[model samples]
Target: MAMLDVKNTKLYISYGIVGCGNMSQAFFGRLFKDNKNKQRRVIMTYTPSNTRAHELADSIGGTSVKNLKYLNHTEVICLCFKPQQLKRFLTDAREIDFSGKTIVSILAGVDLKTLKEYFPNSPIIRLMPSMPVENGQGISLISHTDDVSKKVLDELELLSSKHSMVIKLEEKLFDKLTLVTSSGPAFVYYLFASFAKSLEEAGIRKDNSKEIIHKLFLGALSMIKNDKRDVEDLIADVCSFKGVTAAGIEELGRQNVSESILGAIDKGVERSRELQSEVRSDLPNLQ
Candidate 1:
């Protein structure tokens, strides 16, 4: 209840995080690192076995609680566990009261419908945040149930937008967007690694290859960001007829690398749909 208090100029929030996984840490860490204007009072943390909870709480300056009862007075309760863990947590926390609490979820493939069944009295928000959130440059997809109050939605948006580019999307498109934005970063990293390996094989030192290749990406990204020209035009500007870059482009074309990357994205989207179905199936059985 006492989330923000007047103290000179800074405000604070009372946060109670439920899980302490990588994605959870990414979000909370970014919020902690970027929120210079507001102080975050991490009230408590809960994790099975209590090891990670204690570790994360200590790292983030919070207390690790043994039970959900301590979350009663917290302003925000972040559910940062796997989708399948929802039922177990609900069952274990059945004795605790959750009325009027705002629940923020970062579980992939978990829908608002399933969350409503588990937390009928609490306002639920589902968000898919990428790893770059740790640097305050992530793309996050947000969805909420209709019962959420305007004030709560505004507050959540403000908090999320501070650390990432927040987009309000239909829940039906969450899986598809997750494939493109959330999983896309890993795919891009793999592509960068492949390019770095090619450089290494070409007699470049591994460290130098990595450094140069990463800077190449940064340069290309800067060009793309600054220019409004079509990507094909941008490519044309870089590749002269029969030049080294052109030769590389011709080699990629010969290997159908462009089509292959598109195929990979399609496969990723299909897998995302499969995972969504699996989570939904698990939910119906839980009810």
Candidate 2:
């Protein structure tokens, strides 16, 4: 029997990911343990022989294996491969039995119909979770059919504790989220760095500037979470028309940087949609 059944106190979750690259390591190594499997007994593995994969698995406490048969006994498998690596999984993975399992996919372009075609009988879910899941601050945007209910959603929410945040989404909206949240952090990091660098260049010491940036960013995020004010409104609260914040805003406006950021998001969405199309052949609109 699969070890993930909630009623089983001694359950073991077997996660079989197809890739062990950065995303896999970040997700598995950083967040898997937070599941708090008191037994320290979750069985995890991924496609092997790749150096990055092995390194990440070791970092995350997962066993490494190259054989697909390892999944035959797994209960919860999160496929973390790139789009180009999927067909091989579909072809060779058919021999395994997944009668009572859930398969979560992280490939950008693959859709539910295609996932169903390969693992037809298993309950399937598609999502694009950020790598920050390792840090407990990551947001995971997920979409699926019939694999969860409110009760199940609450159960899954438990996984978010101390290490991750999950937002349920309409399957059709996964594409927008893929770019917004999936690929968001790295981009945001660059923006955060710009803010910090500006402070440093303004004569603020590097460490002090970083502390200020982090505190401000955290405070801003908290406000967004606890209040009804929209993000722009919050920024407006800080920019008193001709004040320091406004001055910075005007400078950014002159540089057209915000537009460039928006353009980057648009391009990322388009590219993700294109990849999704190549794999699913009939993915719903990714916008």
Each candidate structure's TM-score, on Cα atoms with residue i matched to residue i, is: 0.86, 0.76
Question: How would you encode candidate 1's per-residue C-alpha lDDT over 1-287 as one tens digit per residue?
Answer: 12322233233557788998898778776665534333355458889878888877766677889888788868668899987787678777766688878788888877788778778888888989999988888998989988775665666666667888888888888878888889989989998999999999999999999999999999999999999998899998899988999999889999999998788878877876676677766653543
Show where candidate 1 strays beyond 4 Å.
1-13, 34-42, 283-287
Give the alpha-carbon lDDT of every model: 0.79, 0.71
In angstroms, the error of model 2 at 254 is 5.3
Model 1 lDDT at residue 117: 76
Q: How many backbone clashes does candidate 2 have?
A: 3
**Window of ten residues with lowest summed lDDT in model 2:** 1-10
* Model 1, residue 46: C-alpha shift (Å): 1.0
> On a 0 to 100 scale, what is the lDDT of residue 119 in model 1?
80
Clashing pairs in 1: none
Q: Candidate 2, residues 218-283: lDDT per residue as tens digits?
A: 998899999899988988888996899899888989999889988998898888777866767532
Best by lDDT: 1
Error of 1 at 79 (Å): 1.4
Q: How accurate is candidate 1 locally (lDDT)?
A: 0.79
